[model samples]
Structures are given as structure tokens and as C-alpha cells.
Target: MVTAKPSLELVAEVLNGHPRSISRLISRVEARDPECRPALAQIYEHTGRAHLIGITGVPGSGKSTLVRELALAARKTDRTIGIIAIDPSSPFSGGAILGDRIRMNELTGDPGIFIRSMATRGALGGLARASMDAVDLLDAAGFDMILLETVGVGQDEVDIVQAAHTTVVVSAPGLGDDVQAMKAGLLEISDIHVVSKCDRADANKTIIDLKAMLSLGLRMNSTTGWQPPVVRTSAEAKEGIDELLAAIDRHREHLQHSGELAQRRRRTAEMRMLKTAEDILRARFISRDDDIVVDLVERVITRALDPYTAALNLLATLDEGKSDDGGKKRP
Candidate 1:
């Protein structure tokens, strides 16, 4: 059994290139445990070096394929690749695909590629936080490029993209609703727009439509310097990948030289850490005691208390709990 200290030591060892330790460390972090906190802290300290790239679009838009292509390109430069794919919660079955690894098996033999599947636990609770932690873990593992491919649900696109250094929004050729379906904030969040399945006949039309939509955004975000580029690609044919990689490089360069990258990183770090702190407070101090939790739940459910009121009560309980325990609580 790996003790907490040893486990973190092992994680650091894995970050230096030990594959077995890497797998074990990932498993340890992904599991549910209050004890994982220390390891997470060490991992967080080791991060900020990896370039996190988020990719998202509507379902069936071929996002994963594009990510796979990008992985190959990153590998050519001897970069260690980390992939986090969000398999959304199935509305009916409450299940997730959790199966993309089979399709991207070409990366299996390569020691440079580390891929993991994240189940979007639920509507408000899933995807956002778990995905962030998973990326941080990958970053600490010393991956050069961490590619995050998300299930393209319409809402929350902006929040997800904000977690990364760069974002690529993928769309397929004849997706029909390209212009009307894309979100307004998409243009602001995404660093690049990719029209996948470029071999398809309607790809050019999709490009034209996206360009038209971008023109409509000039009133709001036109002063952001470089315009977001639309790159066409065929993941299956393996065409245009080099250009896409170059485009990503260009965006990274622009962000770095323009002093925008530091600002983005600062904002991301602040939000992530604040969110995590809130979640910890919710789980430990507010929800730890049965009577206080039940009271808050009943208040909310019975409509005797609205959400804000309930939150206030919970915070009060948390404060009382802290005062009682004096910040000492065993896991």
C-alpha cells in the first residue's frame, strides 16, 4: 500500500517519467477521498508548465478525432501528451461512453501519450470541477500538452474554455445549424474554430457561415487584436493537421507576447482555486453534520427558505462548526 507521502513521491517520480507510478497516481487522485488533498496540493504546485488546450463542439462534430490528430502532431515534437475526454452523463441511461480509448488505440504503444476518461457526473456538479482537477493532475505529471475534449452540450461552453490556455471549437461540414446554433460567447472564448471533415462537400459553406457570424461580432470584441482563424481539416484523411498545429502555435505566441497569456492564467488560477475552496467548505463544514444539513435541505425543499437564505444558514452552521472544532477535523 502506498502511504500518502509515498504516493505523492511516487506521483513526482511518475512526473519524471515512470509509467507505472503515473498510472497509480492518476487512479489515486481520481478516487473519492478527503485524504487526496495533500497529493492534490503537491500536484497543483507542480503545474502551470503544461499548455492546456480545450476543444468542444456539438455532438457528432468530430471533436475527439481532431484531438487525436492534434495528439499525433504534438507527439512529433517529442512532447508528452495528456488527454482528458468528457463523456457526458446519458440523459436516460445515466451512463457515459467511457470508450474513446478504444478508438484512439494508436496512442497506446507510445509512452508519451497519457489518456483518461472523465464522466460528467451530473448537470451542475459534473464536467467543470472534475475536468479542472484532471487537467491539473495531468499538468503535474509533466505533460507538455494537455488536450481536453468535451462533449458539446450547448451551455457552459464559456466556463469550460476558460479553464484552458487555448480553446478550439470544432464543427462539422453540414451540421446545418452552424450559425444559429453556436453561442455568442463562443467567439470570445475560442482561440480557433475548426471545420472538421474538410473532405465533405459543405465544409466551405460552413467556413463561410462561421466567417459571417464573426463579422457580426465586430461591435463587441473587435479590439481583441488578432481575429480568430477558421481552419478546415479532415481528421480521417489526416489533412491540414500541420496547419492546425501551426495555428495553435501562432495563437500561443500571440497570447504570450501580447501579455494576454499571463492575464488569462491569472484569472484561471484565481477562479479554479476559489471554486475549489467553496466546494470544500460546502462538503466539509456545511454538509458534514447531519442535523444542520437536514435542516438546510428541509428548508430548501419545503420552500420555507430560498436558495440564498439556505446558503446563508449553511454558512452560519459552517462558522459554528469551525468555532466548535477550532479547525480540527479528522478525515
Candidate 2:
């Protein structure tokens, strides 16, 4: 275990691209350790250089293989890559269950590629809360490309759009019902659609279906004159890797030239601000004594008050900045 260092020292180490320091700092960020705040605040200044590409899809869509292949292809252009793979949390340990490190063993010795596996830890929308923080740290470390692979939670993984500049939604043939993708809102959020396992016979059908969907203008970003393209790839055959990379590059250029990049950055900032506020409020609510909450629950259970009224009373108490005793003011 790496011992914690002073925030300034840690920040310097991270800025120098020391892998161990980067990993340790990411751990601190993931745990939401208050001690790392100063370092993170400094680190944020060096971010926004890396292109954040979000890859998400349902389970068994071969997302891992595609990511590994994509990284290799990008590295050929001398681009340093940072991959953040979000895995389902282990029930007992609350750690990443499907380790991407093990899966991408072939890319182990490369200094240019950094892979970090994160556990969802019961956070919804397929990403851990600190995933973006980790992205910032890698960006500060000078990675040219950052691939954020979210947990394959069929629907509701749409949260990737808020975090990634280019969102790629992967689909594989034979993944049971296709309607789940639609229900997941992937159709609306994708900037690029990837049909993986294209070597399979049914792969073309998936590509065609995605094209059909795209034709309907389900992707709202089309208003900017950018149409999402469907790229087919077979990781085993190594076909379409360059095409996918080209598409990513083209999308990046499009964003910059069309001025959508600034809009995305603004949207991301707004989301981070709102999310941080919500997190602080939730932490305050959780840390308080449960007496008031318990009393409200009992009243609601006994029919003395409705849930809404009890909630209003609770909020009113919170608004007054009173302590658990309901009279003493908070510092």
C-alpha cells in the first residue's frame, strides 16, 4: 500500500506521470478522501486536453475486446491512452469483479497505455461517482486519449453522455432482445454506433438496424449537422479498427470545428456543479442524527402525517440550520 503524501508533493508526482502516484491519487479520489482535495483541485487545472471517449453497451457485447483492440490501433499513431473500465462491484468485497487488467494482459508492458479498473460500488448509470475525477488525473498526466468503458448495465447507462466528448455505443448480435437498447436510451445518446463481432453472420443485421434507427434522427445532436455513423468491427479478425479510430478522430475534429466542444464542456461543468452540490447535501443529511428522521418515519407510518408533509417538515428543519435537538444552531 502506498502511504499518503502531502497534497503538493502528490500533485507534483502525478504531473510528472508517475504511475504509482497516479494510481494512489485515483484511489484517494475514488474513496472521496477529503485529504486529496487540494491535490485534485490543482490537478483539474491540467485537464481538458485529453479526449474522453465513452464506450457503453449491454453485457456480452464484447466491449472489452473492442477496447483493447481500439487502444492498440490508437497507440500506433503514438497517442498515449488512458482507459477507465468500470466493472460491477463484488458483493462481498465491493471491488471490481471483472478485472480489465487481466483481460488486457497483452497490453501490460506498454508505458503509453494506462488501464484502471473501477468498481461501480452501487452507483447507478454504469459509472462510479469518481470516474470523471480519475479521467482528470489521467488528462493532467498528459494522455492524449481517455477511454471510459462503463459497466454493461443494459438501460440507464446513458449517463456516459454527460462525461464523454465522443460516446460510442457498441452492439453485438445475438444479445437477446434488441428493444432493451432503445429502452436504455442508447439510441438517443450515441455519437457513434459500433457493431462489434462483425465477423459473425448476424453482425450485418445489427449494423443495419442501428443505421435504420439513426435515420430516424433519434440522436438529438444531429441539429449540429453531425450524423452518427455506424462502424462495424471484428476484434478477432482485427478488421475495422482503423475505421473506428478514424471515426473517432473525425468526430473530434467535427466537435472542434463546429463549436460543439465548448457546448459539451459547458454541459459537463454544469453537471459536475449540480452533482457536487447534491453529493454534499446527501452527505450532510446522512451524517446527521437519525432522531428527527426516525420520528418523521414513525409519524408517517402511524398515519399522523403523510410522507410529503413529513418530508416538508424535515426540509424546513434543515433550512433553519438547527441541530438534532431542533433548537441549537449549526456552526
Candidate 3:
């Protein structure tokens, strides 16, 4: 006798704001369990309701602190929040080293907020595929706001732009030349520029430089026509948190009014679908132990077939298999 699989209905309590169920569902998604797909399919329909926000900046730019403050403030407004903090992977354990939960200890006790820390796990752009899936689960769970905090590796941290409805680029006063650094794709993707640690003396300079850059039409590929606002915040002091939230609200409104929000969600869905298909195809290819792949590898090693040629042949073999299946069905 076979064991019965868990029903998604069993986890309906998770969808109804049960923290334990939410955690278990996210874990199942992150593990990429095959059974989770059906449950995720049901959950996906309820998504696109939460406001997804991406926060990224330099390593010491105080992103985690700002996120904590933001969560605290958002809670006061009666909003439920789900936060995904992406941390650098540990070299040995391959887990998140910084542990954002510890950093956000204050908010842990709050029933309205859920915080999850994920490791980069060799994924570039500071996010793993699992992280995106987890975000979907959180959104489906009915959170009013979802905040994604990246690993903060400068210009390469642009993946959040695709995943977030509103991308906030955080910067501090003394992180080298702000103007020159902004030229490296951050300016293009930023929907809101935040100058964290505003209590520093050089904070004004950073603000001015960002404003000058914006005035020069530096944003080339923004999704919205609304100019990105620059807001200063000292997360430790909690100053300007309200202003930052206000800017985010305005950007959210702009996205809705300018009809960019729907476009962003559509783009995100398209990308996710393509990525899922790619992963499935890749897994099928790797699992095949056929003589064709062995022969192709040997040919490449012997310099008879170039890698590019061998790759095309492999794909051709897959297509041929599909065609043969179709022919058999017709007969």
C-alpha cells in the first residue's frame, strides 16, 4: 500500500495566516519538492495582491536595519509584512551567515510580520530561484507588503528589479563616490533612492549628488514615468522612516495609475514560466544515460565535435524523440 500524499487543503490554515503553516509551506517550496507544485499552483492564483519591495545597497549600508524600521512602521498602519533577507552564503555550511532573524530580533515578537533569511547559495544577483518561489508563497499567504533585502554587492544586484514591484536602492554617506557608482546600472533600476544613516555629516552631499544625477535624466529604463524620489533615513535613529514610507506609497500609486504594475507582474510571470521550463528541460537532459550523450562527450574530447555542435545535436535528439512520440500517437 502507498502512503497518501498531503493535501493542500490540510494547509489551508497556513493560507489563513497561521505562522507554522506558512513556514512549512515555504520550506516545501524552497526544497523544490515535486508535490509542492500543485499546492503552489493553487497559491499562485491568490498572489499579485501584495506590494513587493526590493531593497539593495552596499554591504555596510545598513539595509537590514532600515528594513527592520520599515517593518515596525508598516505594522503601525495595520499592514502585514513578509520579509526575505538574502545573505551571503557560508563557505562551509552553505547557509546564510549573517542570520537576518537575529538582526531583526525586535520585530520577531510582532505577530504581523514574518521574516525569512535565505542564502545566495552561489546564485548571482543576490537571490536564489528558491527565494523567488518563497516570495510567491508569502504573497499568496495574504501579506500586505513583501520586502526583499538583497546581499548588497553593488551593480550586480539588479535581479531584484525584475522580482520587485518597486525597487529601492539604499546608499550611505561615505561609500566612495556616490555619483560615479550610481552610473553602474543602479540608477537605471532604482524606483526610489534611499540615503541611509542621514545623521552623518556627508549625508547632504550624497543626497545632492543623487539629485544631480536624476536631474540629468540618468534613469534610462525605468518602468514608471514618475521620477524616483530620494529619501534620507537614519535607521538607527528612526528618522525619515515615515518619509521613506510615503515615497514608497507614492511609487506604488504611480505604478497602479500609470498601468505599469500590471505590466511588471506580467513580465515577472513570463520570466518565471520560462525559467521553470528551462529547469525542467535541463533536469531531463542531465538524467538521460543514453549512448548519444556518451558518444557526444567522447567526440568532443577527441576534437571531432565542437562543444557548440555537440549541444545542438543533443537538442536535436530531444526534438526527434518528441516527434517520434507524436508520430506513434497518430498511428
Encode model 2's per-residue lDDT on 90-199: one tens digit a residue. Answer: 76877666666666777788999999999888778889889999999999999999999999867666788998999998888878667345643887788888889899
Local accuracy of candidate 3 as per-residue lDDT tens digits, 1-331: 1123363753576578777776777777766677777887877777778999999888888889989999988888999999999888776877667566766899987888988888777677767767878887788778999999998767666888888999998989988885587676787788999999999999999999888888788455443478888899997676999988899999999889999988998888887788777767766676665678889999999999999999999888887766766523110
Residue 37 lDDT, candidate 1, scale 0-100: 63
Pairs with steric clashes in candidate 1: none
When 1 and 3 are scored with lDDT, the better candidate is: 3
**What would the TM-score be for candidate 2 when compared with the true structure?**
0.91
What TM-score does each of the candidates earn?
A: 0.90, 0.91, 0.88
Instruction: Give me the displacement of residue 164 in model 1, in angstroms.
Output: 0.8
Best by TM-score: 2
Sliding window of 10 residues with minimal summed lDDT for model 2: 322-331
Q: Name the lDDT of candidate 3.
A: 0.81
Give lDDT tens digits, candidate 1, residues 1-331. Answer: 4435456467567557566665566566555466666777777788888888888877778887888888999899888899988877777887767876766788878878988887765634225456777787778778999988876656445666657788888878777775566755555577888889999887888888888887777577666686888898997788988998998889889888889899888888887888777666755754364577787788899999998988888777766766888866423
lDDT of 2: 0.85
